[model samples]
Target: MTDPADMIVPLLREMRAENLEQHEQTRALVRALDKRLGGVEDAQKSYRQALTADTLLSKLVTGEFEERIEALENKVRELEGHK
Candidate 1:
């Protein structure tokens, strides 16, 4: 009594609408993830810069300490030679 073609047309329209909605949702999720990823990358860069500064400061302190030690040793050698 009912036509199969008529039934198929309504079902196809429903499927098309659902597909469009899902595509929009996927696009929104991708945009949110991209924004969050940018923040993470910025934080990583800042951390690397801090590490580099710390390393440089440590090297400068160590160099100063080494120079002071050498000066003390030279003074001790001079005093001993005089005696």
Candidate 2:
């Protein structure tokens, strides 16, 4: 019969190698996840900046349009007074 010690040694070595391989695979997956999350965070920041710019532009347009309407109304009133 073959020695039990010889069989056990090879099995233990294979198990250690498998464990190392699995650890490396897990680390690689974590790195990939970190990169994807970083990209998502950058996109969110860009979207926020765009939203702020749009809000400011909308306010400016509304204020300018209101002022123009008021000026036109005043002109119409003056014309009626002169008639």
Candidate 3:
């Protein structure tokens, strides 16, 4: 009494619907992952800039100390030579 053709049509329709649903879900997941990856990249860039700035600041402080010591030593030598 059952018609094989009729059964086949309904099965095909169900498969099509399931395929479309899965495709949409995959697209949404890709969009979300892309957004999260962008955020992570931005954060990593900021961290690198902070590290570079800290290194430059440390070098400047060290240079300042060396300059001051050299100037002080020159003044002491000049005073001894005058006396």
lDDT of 2 by residue, 1-83 (tens): 98998899899999999999999999999999999999999999999999999999999999999999999999999999999
What TM-score against the true fold does each predicted structure earn? 0.82, 0.73, 0.79
Off by over 4 Å in 1: none
Model 2 off-target regions past 4 Å?
81-83
Q: Model 1 Cα displacement at 79 (Å)? A: 2.0
* lDDT for each residue of candidate 1 in 1-83, tens digit (9 for 90 to 100): 98998899899999999999999999999999999999999999999999999999999999999999999999999999999
The TM-score measured for candidate 1 stands at 0.82
Instruction: Report the poorest 10 consecutive residues by lDDT, candidate 1.
Output: 1-10
Q: Report lDDT (Cα) of residue 51, candidate 1.
A: 100
lDDT of each: 0.99, 0.99, 0.98
Residue 27, candidate 1: Cα error in Å is 1.4
For model 3, where is the 10-residue window of minimal lDDT? 1-10
